[model samples]
Target chain A: MDHYTLLNPLIGGILIGLASLLATVLSGKIPGISGVFGRLLVLATPDPPSVAAATYGVAGKTWRAVFLLGLIGGAALSFALWQSAAIFRPMRPLVVMAIAGLLVGFGTRLGGGCTSGHGVCGVGIGAKDSMAATLIFMATAMVTVFIYNRAIL
Target chain B: MKAGKLFLLLVAGGLFGCGLAISGMTDPARVIGFLDLLGAWDPALLFVMAGAVAVYGLGMLVLRRFASRNLKLPTASSSPIDRRLVIGAAIFGLGWGLGGFCPGPALANLGGLRAEALLFVPAMAIGMLLAQRFFGADS
Candidate 1:
């Protein structure tokens, strides 16, 4: 890869790390996208009263909403400024993308985290479960990619 | 939850988006490129993750130093390895492979208002909700 390509991921990684650090230090949160978003989903759903109600409370709900909004705002701002910051193309059919999203959503919840929570923040903290989850998911991702591109495609 | 904490959370979220966008993680092509290991594999994601882990690992150390505060992070799950974790991760990996976008980048790409990302995000939300409703037992 070119030097520019290498630099961008590193810089972005640092920014993400800083964000994770800030969230943990200031609010004792993990800045995990799935965890944060999942909590909001559970809260929004009209499920029977459960642990979430007591856990999220008023403050919990409020902060999560704000944090999610900030994610969009930050991305929008960067898009406007960078213009070419995001190169989004639909590489697969709509059905495929939708199904993928569903699996990701379900898997993250079932697994208790996503790339951000389990791979980044979880591994960073040296949590054994997170480490295991990351390793398993990483291997699976590679294998899936191999199968899709090589076998299926 | 408080105003100050809310503000901090907002900043954190924004910064997280910034990192994703800047690092090129927001681009599905880049992610797919990285995953295409047998072919023209891109190692950029490896470095991106490395940088993030370095900083976050240090942050964990700092938090550990302040362990007396009883910091109960939501990210911490005391559960062991089980069928749920393995199966869920495997399915998630398959989905990620099918669609190059992960939850974080997909959500962040909403900033650009990409049509495909729009389609993906809602579907993901529905999936999360479904999992919570049906699979709350497993978690």
Candidate 2:
């Protein structure tokens, strides 16, 4: 019974959802992970509207730079606090990680935000859609894992 | 609208990321292990959660101090969750189970991890666009 973190996946999922909810409520914006990046990448386009819009709201580079900074800083800080365990877990080749990354981007866009968008924030706001989405995501994830455990990996 | 606000969003991202990292979320191995159960179930992921939940709960307390007609939001914007949500979630989960990647981690990976992200992130975006188009966000 190693209760080191004193937390489990179930609770972790719930907490993650809750944080998304809180952020959405506080900011008056949904905490959609991909959406945040999409906003960041607006500069990829030379289109005036995208550029203007990006300027109107949070400056694309500024926000994106901060976002990246936060991510890296957070990872590094966590590593510092908890050592390697906190920073990263063993991973496959860069190619494997890259493939996983792209699929997720597609999923977030197709699905509209990541788990945080639906699983946590939408849920907190009492949206029916979030609940359904969260359920599906969890079930699918479980099934996917079950399959991997049995068949693939 | 101004440099200041942009700064805030970045700060928020960093804060959020730091929180995620501190909770041991940056690593897919931990996430996968948690899902493994008998094979490699690590319950430590729970602390990452406890801290987050506590933060949210405390946030509510502090939020009340700033609560007004609009609360923390300049305008109380709300979206009603609906059927499309279920479909979106299912699609998202299918990807997650396949590769333990999510939007947050995906974006964070722009730092590196090229090929995996190139494929997955695009798929995720497609999923989101489909939702906005199909659902016609009302609000």
Candidate 3:
């Protein structure tokens, strides 16, 4: 692999791992972004929460909101300071992104977690379900890519 | 709110975002570039995953040992591999392949004020709401 391909990605992955580990140690909470965001959405809804939502008290909600704000704010701060030129746009249409986003939001909740939660943190912790979920994620994503690129576009 | 915890949270979030940008997760094209197995497949993402998992695995092992020794580390529980997990993961994979933006990167990219993220994030929030409604209040 090229130097760029090897160094940045490897180091970046290490950083992500470290971050997740830190979150676990500091708060005893899994740093699953999808789960955190999903909780917020569920809480925000006007309708009464299910028994599960009721269990997620004000303290948990506060931390989650703080963590999310930190995520966005941190990214913005770094982007502004370092001004990384690596960002890209959607190759697909706006409609595609929207639809995909919806699926991501819904599916992650249903699935219990996303890439960071399942693929990285879940697998690392020796969770059988996470391992299974990760395998399914990679397989289905490949199939989708094949269909989208070869058949559709 | 506890200042220390908040600061750590900020640091963790910062590290995660930096990792996403550095690992090229902020770039959907790069993500799609790897997913296109039939085409010119870039295996860089594999290295990213490997690098991440290796570090996390070591950390977890160490943490578990400490916890076993009476440290206050949080415990982890495993979910079941049932229909919800399978169907949900499948749907997520399809969406990921379709959009090239997962939850983390999508939110991180939104920090840059990307228009696509503006659309994706709100719709994603709505989708979460709808999903909870469908699955019942707790789901």
Candidate 4:
């Protein structure tokens, strides 16, 4: 707690909110990372559904690709410009990371959203489903952490 | 017209990534610290969520006034809370708590070319494909 600071998080959070708002205003789509990424994967298959095809279309895929690319590029740019000391601290083993990734991918798809989708955009817009999903995920995460720290670690 | 939309999306995505980086959410340890309620908890993430939710909520309020056919906002799901939602979210939480990475941060980390992201992202994509295949595309 002694090393905690709020300014950066607050600023960063506002920027994220602005980004979500801009995406919706300009494209009329919720910038749910999981939905965008999941649908992109589906679209890449040999025989994508007509619904997905129609939804994504040519421009749809293009925007999704660029948006994702932008996510990577933005982070790179941030490191280059400021916070040069930022580094990834591996908290879990490689095996744990892989398993976690699998669960995240599966769960977000089945659940319909992630933090940006449900926690930010969904809860922001007062969607009941998003709210429910957020609460459940948050609580579950806390419980998991509690168990892991006490039992596993 | 199409190019304009794509450009805006790019900018939005960039800002979103930058925000994630700046807020320190890109760090798995920081995320885990927030979740470590039984341990020494960090409240920075709480403020981050508060700021994001408040600003986005207010923006949506103004946007709602001008809602039109052109504005394709996501509509609330008609279905009530079901098993899929609960199970899915719980599974996601387990993964999140374990890895301390979610879709947005995990993808963003790819920018740094971190080894963890390289491993995590591909596995996550595979998991997504598995879910779509087994659960049907609609899920």
Query: In terms of TM-score, which candidate is strongest?
Result: 4
lDDT of 4 by residue, B8-115 (tens): 889999999998888888888889999999788988788889999999998888777777757766555565678888888888898999899999999989988888
Best by DockQ: 4
DockQ of every candidate: 0.70, 0.34, 0.67, 0.74
Q: On a 0 to 100 scale, what is the lDDT of residue B108 in model 2?
A: 47
TM-score against native, each model: 0.91, 0.70, 0.90, 0.93
Cα lDDT tens digits for candidate 2, B107-126: 44443444544555665555
Give per-residue CA lDDT, model 1, range A11-84, as digits (tens).
88998888888887766666678888888766554545574464356666777778778888888887777745
The best candidate in terms of lDDT: 4
lDDT: the better of candidates 3 and 4:
4
Clashing pairs in 1: none
A25-128: candidate 2 lDDT, tens digit per residue: 53456656666655454433334676455432454446555645665555454445554324444444555554455445545554555655554455444456
- lDDT digits (tens) for residues A20-81 of candidate 4: 88887876677789888887887554345675565457766777788888888898887666
Query: Could you tell me how far off, in angstroms, the CA of residue B29 lies in candidate 2 after the best superposition?
Result: 1.5
Ranking by TM-score: 4, 1, 3, 2
Off by over 4 Å in 3: A1-3, A44-55, A81-85, B67-76, B136-139
Instruction: Considering the two chains of model 4, state its CAPRI-style docking category.
Output: medium
Q: State which candidate, 2 or 4, has the greater lDDT.
A: 4
